[model samples]
Target chain A: MTYCVGVSLDAGLVLTSDSRTNAGIDNVSTYSKMYQCETTPDRFLVILSAGNLATTQAVIQQVKRDVHEGKPRNINNMAYLADVADYLGEILVNLIRKHNEQGGFIADATLVLGGQIKGREPNLYMIYPQGNYITSSSETPYLQIGESKYGKPVLDRFITRDASLEDAAICSLISMDSTMKSNASVGPPIEVLIYKRDQFTTPKHYKFDAEDPYLLAIRQEWAHHLNQAFRSMPRLEESQAQPNSYLRAL
Target chain B: MTYCVGVSLDAGLVLTSDSRTNAGIDNVSTYSKMYQCETTPDRFLVILSAGNLATTQAVIQQVKRDVHEGKPRNINNMAYLADVADYLGEILVNLIRKHNEQGGFIADATLVLGGQIKGREPNLYMIYPQGNYITSSSETPYLQIGESKYGKPVLDRFITRDASLEDAAICSLISMDSTMKSNASVGPPIEVLIYKRDQFTTPKHYKFDAEDPYLLAIRQEWAHHLNQAFRSMPRLEESQAQPNSYLRAL
Candidate 1:
């Protein structure tokens, strides 16, 4: 299981992912799920993956190989960000199909692609295992893949197009923290990348292991704040008599 | 789709459920999912249900009929609370099997049963569609059924055997509110029932329609507090340079 989230903001793009991977309880391992490619000085791209480990690794290796081999349709030479998304989608579909024919196992994988070209705006796309992809809109500025439900309410409440890249990254970490607390399959070291629009170079990156002091501080502070917030909310007993009022009227 | 939660506390038990039911998008309707039966003056029971509506309705009707007919092994005649759980489990499994044989449609339902009989402590059980059931523990004093994930985090943080019944009820309401915000399939009028320890007759019940003033007040106040809490948490930029310090040292 994995949890990867990418937010496209007016200031830039923020992407975060958990590093835990497991085939079963006994087969748990940790691996980096964030891939960064400076396809060219003008073109920078990041890929965050979830689902089948073998399939995602193969897809990443193929993408790197295409750039090295100077293939006709590689990320380096793609004309638009959407074209890069389409290229990744094609690679994913072909790999899954090849594996499905070899035996009877699921080879599905999901991915998020976010980056910018020199003259164009930064963009974010979520590529499905079936080789289809959808981009984020102004109304919905973020996209998530894998173990999404536990962390979604916070994003729905706080994420907006106007949020700063730093704020978006903070919200993403909070989201990942909530998921890790609820699910054992998603763990650290957490990887986060923040890209300022049009920079087209390696983005600001940070990794936090399970015992990292800063991560622990954030977790503790968030929990404290949440408990305080809950306590401050109006109590149910204060409102209980309102429902009974109608009964009294009858 | 539905969301129902039951919590067992030192003071008593708290159960909350949403009222929405739907066969398809066009066929949405509202029906109470909370059922209470006082089989005898000393024995009280409450059942909260989710899953296929027809299957749940049939199971509830059968239980009512058995009580009316004075069946030899009915809920009214059960000796222990566990026996009542077993009885409900048996009825659920038999009904699902009978319907599955009629055609090729699923007839699955999940339920949470909570109550107390005189001379026994209050308790809670979750009955699965496969004719098995599990009870809540002191460490984990709550049981949930139907679209449960969205509402789980708060309960994981706040619920304990030491919590007052009113506090448990408030937490349950917050959990249901979170679920309703995240899932359109689980709507309201919401139903909540709070039972005091050793009381065998009617529990305190409250029904909140979508436009209920108290429900709206809680929702608005909770959201405002959450936003404030998020803003108060420490920012990521304050911790950004620590990761770089290690990299520079290396």
Candidate 2:
């Protein structure tokens, strides 16, 4: 399992992903799930992937190969970010289908594609394995894939279109931290990228290993503050008495 | 979908569940998922259920019917909490099997059984639909069923065997609140029960509707505190410059 989040804010976009992959418990390994593609200086794209490791890696290889070989409709030559997303989706679906047909295997992959083209606004899109995609909206400016629920409450509570890039990045980190704490499959080192709108370049990227000082500090501080928050909330008033009958017959 | 949690603490047990049931998006209904039974003063139990509504309701009906008919091995006749868990698990598996065999349909359910029998200490068990069960431990003092991940981080961070019953109850509420916020399928009204050890009677029970004042207040206060907590955390230092290459070729 994996956990990756992409946030589209008024100021920019933020993407974060965990780096753990496992075919099974005994075969676990650490592999970067975030891929950066800059077809041109003005078009920068980051892809966060989850699900079947082989399928994702194959799709990534195909995309890079297409761009390098200057295919007719490659990521490098796409006119719009949405076109790039569509192209990636097509590549993913074809790869999975080919593998399934050849070996009767069921391989699937899901991706979060987010970044900016020279003339377009920064956008975030979740590409399904079935060769379709959905972009984030103003009301819900974030998209998550793989082991998402554990990290989702924080995003539901805190993410907003107007949030500053730095704030969004921090929120993404916290979300990833929550997921890591709850799931053993989602371990560190964690990768975070903050893309400034219209910059059309690689965003500021930070990677934190499990014992990284800053990461540890964030975890400790968040835990402390959370407990304090809970303790400070008003307690339920003690009921005057136990109800005469606690069971209502069905 | 549903979200129910039971916490075992030194003070006693805290169980909380949401009351939303849905066959599909348009077929949602409100149904109480918490059931209490006190066959005798010495043996009291509360069952929190999740999964196929028909299956859970049928299992509950069967248990009640057996007790009413004075079955040789009904809940009333069980001597240990584990025995009761076993009985409930058997009923669940048998009911599911019978329905599947008769109609070629698959219906499943999971339950959390927590309470006390006169001679034994308070206990908590999660009975799977397959007739297997697992209990909480000192290190992990809580068991959750259905839509569990969204609400699990808080429990992992705060719950402990020594937490007071009130604190455990509060934690369970927060856990439920988190689940409700993240998932549309899990909603209110919320039901909470706090059971004190050594007292076989029904625990203090409170139900909070979506519009309930206290529930609203807790939501507001928790949101406020969470924001404050986030703001108080130390911010990551700004990196001096964008790296020449942010991507390392895989």
Candidate 3:
């Protein structure tokens, strides 16, 4: 299992993926899940993948092959972020089909793609195992796959288009931290890619490790704050105040 | 679906559960998931359940019947909290078997039980579908079932024996908030029960609707604290500036 999250914000897009992959408790390994596809300053795309490593790698390899063979069948021809998502979905579907034709094993995988194409606004999409995809929008401005629930509450409550890129970056990491605490399936050595809108060609990338001080401090303080917050919740009055007063009023 | 969490703290035990039950979105309804088998003063046992409502109700009814029958299987003869968990588990197994034997539809469910047994310290246990149960301890001080993962991180980081019942209550709600955000299957009209150690009597129970002012405040403030904590993390430069940089050594 893996945890990958991508947030589409007014400033740009924030994408993150953890590197830990494990077939079992004893077989953990590290693999980079962030990939960049660029065809010049006007067109830039980033993909963060989760799920079966074989399926994702195969999909990426096929995409690379298509680009190398460059013609009518290349990702370079995919003019929009949606087009890119569709193209990647096609690659994954074809890879899964071809692999299953050989009768060995097929993998379950998902990919998140977000970036800007020359003339359009930035966009984000999540590509599913069966080659279907959904675009993120203001109503639902984020997408997460694999080990997603633990980190999701904070995102649901706080993330918005008005959010700053700096803040979104921090929010994504906090989400990842919650996931890491509850799930052994997702671990550190995480990749964070931040792309500012219109600055499509370049994005800042950071690799986070387990002992990263800021991560540790956030974990500690969040824990402390939660305890303190709980301590401060008004205690139930000893008198029998109508327990269902609010519900009855409703 | 349901979300239920139990924590064993030095101040006593905290149990919280959401009341939503659904066969599907169209079939959603509210059903109480928290039940107590307290004979008051002499023995106090609260069962917080998540999963099949029918199964939990059957188990509760069975326990009530045992008490109504008296003598051989009453609370007086249960002996300990462990015995109470076993009794509940046996009832669950029997209920499942009877439901299956009659060819009725039955969904799997899990129960979390904890409280004092008059003469001993407060204890917590989680009962599974098969009627087997596991107890909480120093190493594992909490138990959750039915939409557990999303709410698990906070408890993993903060729950301790010395934690106040109030603190446990808050943390569990925060966990529920996370689960509720990630999974539509769990939702509001939440129930919270607190057991103070050695009190051996009726525990305090609170019901919170979606708009409970205290809940709203914590949710808002928690979101702020999480974002602030994330922003407060030092940048990579400061993280890397240490002369004893462990990451560089790695």
Best by DockQ: 2
The 10 consecutive residues of candidate 2 chain A with the worst lDDT sum are A239-248
lDDT of 1 by residue, A1-250 (tens): 9999999999989989999999988899998888886467888788999999999999888888887898898988888999999999999999999999997677899999999988899999999989889999999999999999888878888899999887788888888998898889999999888888978765788898999877898889889988887777677764463343111100
DockQ values, each candidate: 0.38, 0.59, 0.30
Give lDDT per model, in order.
0.86, 0.88, 0.77
Cα displacement (Å) at residue A150, model 3: 0.7
Q: Model 2 RMSD to the real structure?
A: 1.4
lDDT of each residue in A153-214, candidate 2, tens digit only: 99998899999887887788889999999999998989888888887755788888999888
TM-score of each: 0.95, 0.97, 0.88
lDDT of 2 by residue, B132-231 (tens): 9999999999999999999999999989999988888878888888888889999998988888999877578888899987788788888998898788
**What are the runs in model 3 whose C-alpha is more than 4 Å off?**
A38-41, A97-106, A213-233, A240-250, B38-41, B70-76, B100-106, B220-250
Distance (Å) between predicted and true CA of A30, model 2? 0.8
True-structure lDDT of candidate 1: 0.86
| lDDT tens readout by residue for model 3, A1-250 | 7898899998889888888998878999988788776455677777888888888877777777777777586767767778888888888887778777886677778899888888899889999989999999897899998888888876876689888876777778878888888888898887777778888655777777888776686667766765565555555544522243111100
Please state the CAPRI-style docking class of candidate 1: acceptable
Q: Per model, how much of the real contact set is kept?
A: 0.33, 0.50, 0.28
Candidate 2 regions with alpha-carbon error over 4 angstroms: A240-244, B240-244
Looking at model 1, the pairs that clash are: none
